[model samples]
Target chain A: MGQDGSVPAYENASKESPQPRPRLRRSVEDGWIAGVCAGLAHHLGFDVRVVRATFVLGTILLNGLGLLAYLVIWALTPQALDGEHADAPRPAPTSLPRLDRAIRALRTSGRDEAFGNVLGGLALVVLGAALLLERHGVNLRLGLVLPLGVIVVGAVIGWSQLDRAERSSWLNESSFSGRRGVLRVGVGLVLTIIGVLLLATQERGWAGMGDAALSALAVLTGAVVILTPWGLRLWEKVKREQAQAIRATERADIAAHLHDSVLQTLALIQRKADDPAQVQRLARAQERELRAWLYGGGQSAETTLAAAAKAAADDLEDRYGVPVEVVVTGDHPLDPDTQALVRALTEAMSNAVRHARPPVSAYVECGASGIEAFVRDHGDGFDLDAVPADRLGVRGSIVERIERHGGTARIRRLSDGTEVALTLPVHRPVNQSLNQPVNQQTLPLKEAHDA
Target chain B: MPEPRATTHGPIRLVLVDDHRMFRAGVRTELDDSLPVVGEAGDVDTAVEVIRRERPDVVLLDVHLPGGNGRGGTDVILGCAGTTTESGAPVRFLALSVSDAAEDVISVIRAGARGYVTKTIVGEDLVTAIHRVADGDAVFSPRLAGFVLDAFGAAAGEIAEVDSELDRLSAREREVMRLIARGYQYKEVAKELFISVKTVETHVSSVLRKLQLSSRHELTAWAMNRHLL
Candidate 1:
């Protein structure tokens, strides 16, 4: 403890040195006891055995002053937490170093049993010294004193070496939670009863009973003092975990917002920069879309078939260079039917633009029982039978797509062009809901539309 | 109706039609002083009225507009066809559209447009096209000519009779002719037929003579008119 005050002076000397300083920390990897010789050898750039031999020689020549100095250094130096020792210079092999190596081998042989062996060795040494003193007519009793000193030294080493969390858990394995608290109280009460009964049975009177009671009260108070701080610390840890979870959610929201708004707008600007008119149009459209998304304007309940058809036409014109003219007459259809019809119409219109000459026209009308649409093109038409099997534009996209929606597609060739007329039933079947399976129906006129 | 005399040295009378005002102004500024802008209109109704009132020699028309069922250029062309010069010469229309789509090209050409050029065409080329259309010669952007040929060729399939001239070519010459008609360059035709460029040239000359055609463009037009492309 007296040598502990000199540690900061050595740390300061190492910091002030311009040359690379070998850190003067205790070498737990290659050390006897507190590794004072190993630490000095590492700092002074000498072999550890050379430092140990110098210490042994100096202690013999200086009449035991070297041994006291060694103990002081051992108490002062800190263990090198990072176990590395290669920085120091090596020395020539000598007999003394060889003897030190043999000693290290013996010390490490039963390393796992080292703690109990060391304690037992100290007890034997003290007992032998006491017996020798008694034989020389000096009375000494070491039974309780030696054991208590050993315990005190062990506690001091443990308290200095263990980190904070490990020390806390070692102090209270059963934290002051409900079940453990009840168990601890039961054990304490049983011990107190046993202590009081022992005192009464031993013919120790009221004074012994009072002493036992006071000691019990002191133990309970000590437990309360220790457990209250631990409970507060555990609560703080839980709160910190909750805060981290909330921060993660907030970061996710910010990422989503950047992806939707800033990144999408930048991509649009890059794609449409070649044409100024197109760039302007895209900017205006995105502004409206963003504002609608931000201000909660997209929640309107009414989505008409006509408006949807117009949007699909515009999208087609934007994607493919073909233009379409759509004319919608009468009221909007039911929402589910409207969606189905819009999809079917988009497919038919896509077919017309791809296969036929365009300037295509779409006419939509809603009647009492059903809705109808006609997509017409004035291109050079083909024979219905002549359409190859691989051509899905007419057969699959137009006919099958409409039929899947409980609708019918009729293709007829006029003298100048071809027209596809689609009719969708407004009401579903009696037993079917909006989300029911598709109804597959066959048309009678398979050989139609020779355009 | 009197025939408008072809004046060689004078500027062609032109009416510019477009929905975008800035685009119209840009075109007006880009055109040389030789081709004067006679009038401008944004929609189909106004365009037709302006064309009839002005009776310009060439009408530069945009294919899409707000009025007249959204087929603005075709509508203007069809409307002008009814009111011609005293000599029965129709007002020539040159479609100037941003869209180079096959459908737009074919539809306007079918509606009596004498020429079609996309908006990407530079000022000099557009001026040349206007002059050619005003002179009663068909003018088209190179790719747009293909669309025109396809549309009119398929329409005339029933009326056209088989020509013995195509049969006169040898098989190798015929292959060269088909490739040349489809707009392959001479070197491309040579590589495709696994023949030398000189051999391809020889075949082309022979095919041209047999068909009584003058150039590659004429051969393409003749083949398309016969629905052979």
Candidate 2:
């Protein structure tokens, strides 16, 4: 044994333990038909030739009783799994490797109680009898016996596949089993066809054989039609259960999101219920986030009076937790003059929303003549005459800014609401298209706010 | 502010139509006591029935309702098109909605509603709008003005150049709409544009007629549909 570190951990584990048990499975590598005789000889320390000869004789003397027993054993036994020896690399005896293999198989078999010992002994007897008959001069009909043997071998190959346990094991495990099953079944079918051809060509007609094959196919199709619905219902049930599991996982994800955001915000709002402003702020923030998440596709990127007003409105709403509705009729591209107007409008809107009852409304219209914006609130109107002109509340924020662009701002007190109207005339020279880019250097300082 | 309890004729009879029970209750409480609510309905069929039975001066129609063969407020407006008050004046519809969608606003307007106002409007402004609608005058909220300007301004641009006199906004009409969009009252818009208040109302009424009755503006309708869809 190399006993190197590269050896698999299982080999070391097997050596350290008392012994590694072997399972009662047919030998795939050594089998002539289904590997039953080879696996039996290996397990019982008998020669494989001895096992084979006994079965052949038993088939002749027992009137096919031995064949029936072999078929039953083949159906019950699992074929040796590929890589069984790979689990532990056993050292082979130098002179007699076959004997050593038998001994090793025997040793592994000893790890667990030997299964079907009586059946194994019976196999030895059959092989012994066949070996004796071969030694003697036994005259048999070669034509009849050869065809029957070939047919029986094909039948045995197909019968071995009836091991439902092994078939289903790899059927659930991987596609490799399906491929292997297809290949073996193909070989069995070819063998059976060759045997049938031989029997038909031997002083017989093909019509009878054709009739038999047609009848068998008809019976199989009838059986299939009668049995298909049971399998279909099983498949549908599996599919439905899979879909249900996926929906459950999605529900869990949504629940987690609600708990992390909505529930936490609700708890915070409850704690700050005494402060109406704080509660409103929290609730509004949560609602906006949830709506954006649900509807997807957040605000679009645009540089227009409407977009700027929306951004300003969103900012004020976030800060104060009050609703600001900004409605713009005609959109105009941002310019130096328009930028000044938007700044004044933002200031006016902030003052109205902050000091007055909401939801505040801002309306901006861009016509061929000019662009106008109004911020209105339905609170107690403020007396413009009472406010000092030196303060930055209205004069500095709204009136003076619009005056720079040769526009006007008016704070009118309506009977039901207070309105601040700001208008900026279209200043682009008649020659220039409104779509063309203008000189950016005229006002670079305030350009960042547009973004 | 003093509530206008009754006009020279009488307090304007009103019919309330909205799907949400809570919202209808809130509006009733917030409304001026002078505008006597004659009837109420929750869907289009009930609204048409109530309007025909009560002959209210103004019907506050919700844009999105649960019923009416899926057309909502538009169906109600069309269904009650022939209904009139006992005094022989036609019943008017004023749309109220929380939707800012241009399709919802334009559809109801096209279906013969006199005005459109968002639910966020102040109680006093809503009362004033209702009064104006009952008085056979068109009422345009700032948002509705914006939508109108957007729809008519860009749409039919090609057609407007070919025939500027028809299916297009005149300079005066554009100025009136812009002023209205700036939250200017009719009196204020007249003052700002140096026109009489009666002339301002005429401009607004003409705009409304062009918006609703113009069959030559197929391009406008197509553009609005494409923009909405």
Model 2 C-alpha lDDT per residue in residues B28-62, reported as the tens digit of each score: 99887689999999998998888989998899999
Q: Candidate 2: lDDT over CA atoms?
A: 0.64
lDDT of 1 by residue, A362-423 (tens): 76655556777777765676677677654534455556656667888888775445677788
Candidate 1 local Cα displacement, residue A29, angstroms: 82
In the order shown, the chain A TM-scores of the predictions are 0.32, 0.42
Stretches of candidate 1 off by over 4 Å are A1-302, A318-321, A367-370, A390-397, A400-407, A414-417, A424-445, B1-22, B25-36, B39-229
Clashes in model 2: which pairs?
A53-A127, A54-A126, A54-A127, A55-A127, A329-B146
DockQ each candidate and list the results.
0.01, 0.17
lDDT for position A68 in model 1:
45
Q: For candidate 2 chain A, which ten residues in a row score worst on lDDT?
A: A442-451
lDDT of 2 by residue, A208-231 (tens): 455434433432232232222223
Total clashing pairs for each candidate: 5, 5
